[model samples]
Target: MLEIKNLHASVLDIDDSEILKGIDLKVGKGEVHAIMGPNGSGKSTLANVLMGRFDYVVTEGDVLIDGNSILKLRPDQRAHLGMFLAFQYPAEIPGVRPWQFLKAALDSKADANGEDKMSVRNFSKLFDEKIEAVGINPNLVKRSLNEGFSGGEKKRNEMLQLEVLQPSLAILDETDSGLDVDALRIVAEGVNSMRSPERSFVVVTHYQRLLNYITPDVVHILVKGKIVKTGGPELALEVEKDGYKQYMAEAEVNA
Candidate 1:
């Protein structure tokens, strides 16, 4: 459902700081792929570039969703195309409550996709159901979007958004970061519940702890902006055991 073709991207302000170098990947419908690498291996960069973030420029290659190019589309347009990105550091919108933020986002996506906007009554019912499913305290959501929320709460908040939005392709960039055992398990359960035949996921993370609960169909070792190795779930265990030292050394020499 998602394809990245020889993608190359670099920081817009610096000419020499190329982050992604010829990344080629294909994720099929219903597949879950895990991308594991060391710090600064361009994992988060890939996520940001896919969303058409303005800070980075794609110098070569293309990103296609269901055979259509999303390279030139804006971030909102990409969201409308069923691409959702759970940020590593989810931004805090202090003035907006979760209810208001989500309703507007759903309406915007509906208008962009030519779908009918969800009525308040229906949205309220669904929102309440998801809030409970994600184990979020209703009072917390009423406060502000990621405002004054603890680390675990923010992660659960992302899961709540995912459950409510139900995007086609979900790219989770280090959602497991800063999460404790219980919080991590809750987030993984949230992701597991969302898996389906029509939905795909690309989870970018540094550790394999999250992978234990959400077993991925494919595991990729991305080093120095390139995917150097691809394998089954066992690859993650290998990374856990041997670490990324060998891969990092090899990639730095070649990449």
Candidate 2:
């Protein structure tokens, strides 16, 4: 469903310094791929570039959804084409209530896709149902988006967005980073519930704990801005047991 070809990106306006050297990956429909790597491996950079973050400039390569290139599309344009990125650090919108923010987002997507927006009555019913299913407090929706929310609450809110957005491809960048065991399980359950033949997930994490709950169809080791290894769930276990020292050295040698 998603393809990255020789993707090379650099932090814009910063000496043309490259972060992603040459990333090539393919994620098929109904597949979940986990990217595990050490810090400074450009894991999050790949996610941001996929989302068309302006701060990063893609000097080469193309990111495609389905088969068409999305290099020229803006972030929201990518969303219109069924791409979603759950931020590692969710931003707090001080004055935007969760209900308002989500409703507006869904409406915008609907409008962009030439569909009718959901009626407030109907939307409220569905929203509340998801809130219950995702185990988010209904009261949390009344507050400004992520404002004053605990780390777990923010992650829950991210899941709530995923549930409502229903994107074809979801790229979760370190969703389990700050979450405790309970929160991690909740987040994993939320993701697992969304898995299906038509949906795909690219879960970028540093540890294997999250993988325990949401087993990926494929696992990849990203090092020095490129994917050096791809394997099944067993690779994650190996990384957990032995660490990335070997991978790091191999990547340097290859470089």
Q: What tens digits encode model 1's per-residue C-alpha lDDT throughout 19-97?
A: 8999999999999999999999999999999988999999999999999999989999999999999988999889899
Compared with the true structure, the alpha-carbon lDDT of candidate 1 equals: 0.95
- The whole-model lDDT of each prediction reads 0.95, 0.95
Return the TM-score for each candidate structure: 0.99, 0.99
- Where model 1 places Cα greater than 4 Å from the true spot, the runs are none
* lDDT string, candidate 2, 121-188, tens digits: 99998899999989999998898999999999999999999999999999999999999999999999
Which residue pairs clash in candidate 1? none
What shift in Å separates residue 217 of candidate 2 from its native position after superposition?
0.5
Off by over 4 Å in 2: none
Where is model 2 poorest over a 10-residue stretch in terms of lDDT? 8-17
lDDT minimum window of 10 residues, candidate 1: 246-255
Compared to the true structure, candidate 2 yields what TM-score?
Answer: 0.99
